[model samples]
Target: MRPVLIALPVLALAFLAGGLALTRPVTVPDTALAGLTGDAIAGEAVFWAAGCASCHAAEGATGAARLVLAGGQRFASEFGTFIAPNISMHPEQGIGAWSFADFVTAVQEGTSPEGRHYYPAFPYGAYRLAARQDLADLWAFWQTLPSADTPSAPHEIGFPFSIRRAVGAWNLLNLHDDFVVTGELTEAETRGRYLAEALAHCAECHTPRDALGGLDRRAWMAGAPNPSGSGTIPALTPDRLTWSEAEIAAYLNDGFTPDFDSAGGHMVSVIRNIAMLGDEDRLAIAAYLKALPPAGD
Candidate 1:
């Protein structure tokens, strides 16, 4: 009995130690951004394409007001409601104080400057594929943005879901930088793939997720159920989306479908951001969508 009790305590200690190691934050090296110069002009395009304003801007903000990233948006998921944090240029209330390495860690590795894991709601898994130069440029552009002193709201989560450390384990399982669309060819399609998969994170919502909340890549862009439980998110695969490339490009540019239907729901917000992009970019997105294999194939 004495031997059994000793072994039980030893096992418990081992388990605790293992958990600590697993949850340790994964960060980029301080030298990761070394020698890389940031260009704010290029980053402006990346910012709009990534739709940073969609989740971080003040609710109901319009026009140039969208540039103010005072994040207080609420995102509901199966786990809980996650609030977008203030990412404005405010030194205290936002990421203005973060170094380029810190931004890279947060955006690419989903680890905060304080070595904490961020929830998947921020979509770093997709953002991880972003080019290092783009990240540097983004950081440069971030610095140029107007400062907002809006404090971040805490996420409304419960129990195990609220455990930020557990997110490290989740990252181990689901976080990857691989391109979803393989066997790509055209230069335009390649560019489009990067835009859709990395920057815009179209798959984050357009694709279905597994029980653990990781993307089900097999169904890639086949659409998914709305997390709000209101209705289904439409599939973007060739199986369902048969729109012509020209029509798709037009829709992205002006929010008008082939049938003259305007973009609605959350897409309206998405279109607002995409509309700011160059015409070539909209066309690239269309070409990329046209290149995808039908769902289930």
Candidate 2:
């Protein structure tokens, strides 16, 4: 993980001072999003699954919860700050008129329409496992949003990371798995897999990293430091018999611990998404967790 660009002291100061107005870049909508329907309820569930508000509209911002896809939120860490872009319906600023095909490609392949590449920061790797139907629903939901004219902010990075072409190399090395949810299936298992691997993207942040910032599968979801540097994200392993499968699942669904503890950090927002799931989903995820052995435990 290198910074995407080098900066002078004055330029860096201006970026920090202007907040996010330091960079502005755009290409025509490349992903085809025109297939999306106008349905709202199903789309709402998709919204929760994608965690759109986490970066696009932060929980820390005023009206963040209601801001939906209007971009301009900032996520900071040791890597540098990543400004979330507006995805509202606004044609000039946000993604108001994108087609469903565009949305699907962007979510599953991380390829922007007209062929621009999305940085791995978008978490499209985990999202690849998303079912087309669910993705379509999400597309439908985004279409109904209030279009906002808020603009995207530029990123501040240093060195090799600054080169947009470098991301292609990173993707070639790290993005080996295209989202596929095959193998064995019970309905519960499949659903659990989809949520854990795709939309929820649980392992994207919770799994520890290797030297180059790829996932350390050996420690998968065994609790890792938050990349955002906010706080420690809890391990989701089944290490202790005491934690129990049911307890974790329930906690995910409602944010309540067996001992009356509550979800915190990025999880507070995560819980809201999990809670939107049906009871069967919550239980299936619980079953999957209980079945796992903690990494290296």
Candidate 3:
């Protein structure tokens, strides 16, 4: 009994130590931002491509109001409800005081200035693929947006899921810094691949997950049971969609399918964001989708 009691305590300490090591925050190198100047005008395009307003803005806001970014939106998941944080330019209520390094760390490593792990709900896993230059531009453009005085609401997650340290283990399995869809490519296909896999994060919605909540890369964009627990997200692969490149581009630009059916559900906001990009960007995205191998092939 005495030996058993002694061993139990040792085991507990080892477990705790392991958890701490696994969840350690990753920091960006100071040199990452060196010699990089941000372009606010160009950053506006990155902002739209990243679809920041869709999640960070106040719920139900439209038009110019989407730019407010007060961040009261609630996302319900099996883990719990996550409230989007205020990312506006307010010093106290938002990220006004954050430096370029802080922003880059948050986007790429999912670590905050205080070294806390942001919930994966923010989709930093995909943002991890973003180029440093694009992030610099995004930071500059974000600075020009209106500041919101609204404070962020706390996430309503419980128990194990609420423990941010556990995210470190999750990251180990799923958080990759490399870009998806690598290979030799034309300029349009390359641009589209980056837009889809990095900035737009289309996979976040269109792909399914395993029981551990990590994306099932084997089934990439083959559609998923929507996280909202409603209708299915359609597969975008050539086998399922069969839309011509022009039709895909037109749908992205105008939200009308070849059959005149409009995009609905969460995709409506996605279309709106894509609409803010140039025609070439829309065409590029379409071209990339059309080039994808058929699902399961």
Candidate 4:
């Protein structure tokens, strides 16, 4: 019993060390978006596309959380809990002192104000492809918003996971810091890619995971029980991969299926966001869906 008791901490430490050590580190690159200047109109579009109010809004806010962007929401999962941080221009806690470049890199590249890698949990992977002008404009818009003085609460992961430094390793294995990846340019394909790969950010909730906390590419967008331990979220692919693009598009746009049912779960909020986008952008997103690999499940 004495030996067992002595070995417990050693085994625990070893386990944590192994988990923490499987991290990935990356240097965020200056994206095509990094060099553009801010514009108000473009910023408003960016705000809508990124669903800026979703996380930053006060618990009850129905619209933008402009003044209330001092993060108050608590997101829980198996990994533990994360309290969204204040993002208003409050100097002490929020991004008040951050320059446009600072905010741009953070949004587009997953780098923090001074250039630390942000957890993909920030959802920058989708924001990565936002045009440079749009990113800059959003920064300008953020500057005009009223400031919040409240600081963000810290994450509640225990031990090595709580050692934010260990995130350096996680980034190396699972995170990709590059905000944009260039490819052959075509207006239609580019539009589709932008909506699916970036703005719509389809992969975040739909993608499944491995035991080590990395997404299983095998199940990319196949859907999983949201690990917060709510029951299974269900698959996006059509039942038996039978839903056509037109049906999926309709489901996304109206939240009602041709099968005479309605979309639910995480998709409810997603449909609402899509509803706000212009028809062109919405169609682009729909087009992208047709191109996604069918659920490998």
User: What is the Å distance of residue 294 in model 3 from its true position?
Assistant: 2.1
lDDT of 4 by residue, 155-246 (tens): 76554445454445444445553323244545654686676666666767777765545666556567776755567766655443457666
Indicate the TM-score of model 3. Answer: 0.92
Predicted structure with the largest lDDT when compared to the true one = 1
**TM-score ranking of the models:** 1, 3, 2, 4
Error of 1 at 121 (Å): 0.2
Better of 1 and 2 by TM-score: 1
Ranking by lDDT: 1, 3, 2, 4
Candidate 4: C-alpha lDDT? 0.63
What C-alpha RMSD separates each model from the true structure?
Answer: 5.9, 7.4, 5.4, 5.7
TM agreement with the true structure for every prediction: 0.92, 0.79, 0.92, 0.76
Clashes of each: 0, 21, 0, 11
Whole-model lDDT for model 3 versus the true structure? 0.84
Worst lDDT 10-window in candidate 3: 1-10
Per-residue lDDT of 1-297 in model 1, one digit per residue for the tens?
A: 233343443345435645669657789998867899999999998998888898899876779889899999888887779899999989999989988999999999999999988999998999999999998888888888999999999999865566676666667668776888899469888989999999998998899987667899888899999986688888888778999888988898888999999987678878888888898898889889988889864
Name model 3 segments beyond 4 Å from true: 1-20
Residue 108 in candidate 2, Cα distance off native in Å: 1.8
Candidate 3 structure quality by residue, lDDT tens digits, 1-297:
233343343345435755668658788877867999999999999999999998998766678887888898888776789999999999999999999999999998999999988988888998988888999899989999999999999999876666676677667778986765667778998899889988999988888876667788877788888877688999988788888888998898899999999998878888888999999999899878876766774
